[model samples]
Target: MTTTTSGPPAAVRSVSPRATVRLLGAWHTTGPAYAALADALRSAVLAGSLPVLTRLPSERELARALGVSRATTSAAYARLRDLGFATSRVGSGTVAALPRDASRHEVAAPPPAGDAPASDTPSADPTTPAADDTIDMSQATPSASRALHGAYTRALEALPAYLDGGGYAHLGVEPLRAAVAARYTARGVPTDPDQILVTTGAQQAIALLATTLVARTEHVVVESPTYVHALEAMRRTGARVVGVPVGDVEAIESVVRRTGARFVYLVPDFHNPTGRSLSADERRALADLVARHDVTVVGDETLTDVDLVGAGVPAPVVGDGTDPRLVAVGSASKSFWGGLRVGWVRADPQLVRRLAHTRQVLDVATPVLEQLAVTDLLEHRAAILPDRLAALRAQRDDLVDLLHERLPAWDVPRPDGGLCLWVGVGRPVGRALAAAAVTEGLRVSPGPLFTPDGSGQDRVRLTYTRPAGQYEPVVDRLRRAWERVGGR
Candidate 1:
């Protein structure tokens, strides 16, 4: 006799309600514990689960809930504050602040049904990916925890003595400047400490340079499909950006001559997105053209060290000492950890001084702790290079192989170095593909994101920086999405 003893229909057996605070599944435990917590929260906010003005639990409550100490919660909140994600008043508990784009939300919605077959005619939703889409090969960043944390830890231990002062200045701590100069000196460019200006990151350095050098309506030459953020920076300064195809020295020269541009931004080593490096001849021609046109050259060498194929290319020489127009940008973010936020600009002493002054007004100074940490990494550079290079090479190879196997129709060029491969999808399906990828729980930077003029509609930049395990799943998704979109 099955006794129906339920008073309210056995209380209607149901699955447990999902947690309001969903921790990011992809977060790797590294760096500071507080940082991990902050990143998890940030991801949630970015993903739109935690909407703006949502009241977060108290520190004690969160600590207990997350199984962490209250101090950890406090530190995590502090990090959130630093990143502009939360705010606290004297009496009110911490509340969620909107991201830069306050109106954006990441509310979970059901994925769109598989779309119909792809045609040469463009779809209404250009960013939708096909149903069988597997890999999201769009981001261009290194995988987390490349073992540089050990170097950073060692660096931190040696930093106590240097923390004697108030630690606020725009020129950066002297030791870090010296260390950066030494790196350039080792790399064939003889640089002095005076010629180095420490910045928060390569992005900040680019912004400062743009602010100081670019005037409203002045023309700036950028490589087609150049670093998107850099292009944005140029636009922020109200500069007219003209794209010269990467590896086309003549095209760049013609633009420089025609526009009489004040500056030209070039990525000589493993150019972003495309991963094409300028040949020795092209670099020389670029330098000569800039010199003849009296235009400043901002050489971004952020991806200089991730060389996976053949002998590493030589750094571009911007002519003799008298040339005050060449500025080289370097960063520890790509080769090391992005959290370090330490980058330097190598230029003439006068120009460096000017940039330093501009930096003073903008950020006052980069944190001394991070600067010291990067300085230590630079001093022990030999110990870290081999591991970094090996990890990146493995990732690049894994991605390339996966793409070939699953995405045979996609034209994925094998990059010689850097963390990303620029893939051509044979048609202008990038927007559709990106939108579709997001529905499949993948986020990607569509090709048009990199182009200033919304061109490159057929290309996508895929990062090989995720874990090896992620490659197959991503590719599988891409394959499924492609098939659903009727891969030609």
Candidate 2:
């Protein structure tokens, strides 16, 4: 009886088991299933779970483990290889690799030394650094106008006769010059068409001024945290730039008196990066000091029209009639659009002629199309300006609210006008924070980019031109980076 029972049990146990098939989820079975899987893997890699050079699972093993078709797994692996995220060998299977993005290497590298030369220097190649999405807060520019198309169209219609004339005159279109002069008059600086000389942009205006005024090794006074590019331009002309502290009238006056500087470069209207406007008394004092010292004041009013806050603030160029030493520079680039590329220097007629003659050696003249476009916008200023001011104001408020909510540690002064907020990081981590931000797909203009001699390492200028939706992510990323750098 025991033998019979044992025999039956052995036969039943020896019977072969049936093969079973398992189904994969829709993500694995779809036409682009491999792409979906590769994306998932990419997310994992970006999250730092799988570090660079780590070996990935074998295609066959992964397919079996995930219950997916071998072809699907192979395709996913191939996709990763193509993206430079993985590499495969006949015997070694696949291994994670560094991302093909050039910026990845930059992020991984140590922060640059504080005194490193600017990337824009003539000898320096900007393209050498693997191109990353750079958030350039160095410049203060406004967004394009909705009415630009109409303005440009009108300009094109008026361009035929203008084109027929000899195009090599260094002075810009007479009408645009008149328009610029009219703007100066409207702003309380009385001027004639003969007083304005249009240039390629504010940059060109600065370059021309610097070249014309500064003799080799001449002393040029600039605010301590002035626009770096302007400082560079002045320096390029062999001018010894003297930094004068802003916000305090006495500091600037003291520097002016002490240096006997030939020229003073200033941004009086909601001063760039700092957002501090000089009081009327301060402006009067500055004008008096410049007049007394015979220092030619080159007033950069690029941000003059971008009055988002402090709407009642007085103009910075109300010169005392005694001196007539002020050469005010205004640009449509910031008030309207950068693509307009139209700017004018408001000065005495003789000085304008000199600048025009100097400009002939550089750019023959400002583009006819740009000049006309700007003229049209200036003509319709009443209709277009209110909307622009309103939009900019809203953007400024939105950015301030976002900073307050997400990055309470950051001390951002709400600027009266201008497109950016000069933020105080309270520590010299601008470079480190910027490096960390790149890893998270954020580009920030470190404060040193604005300072002469690569100072201001504890600050960064943040623009509000980005719409509210775009602005939020930037703030979040910056907050994360700030936290990583132990920001206060």
Candidate 1 matches the true fold with a TM-score of 0.72
> What is the per-residue lDDT of model 2 for residues 306-379, given as tens digits with 9 covering 90 to 100?
77754645654647323558888888887789988888888777887888888877778888988999999998
Off by over 4 Å in 1: 1-137, 144-147, 317-322
Prediction RMSDs, each to the true structure: 22.6, 24.8
lDDT of each: 0.70, 0.68
Candidate 2, clashing residue pairs? none
Error of 2 at 304 (Å): 0.6
Give model 1 RMSD, 1 decimal. 22.6
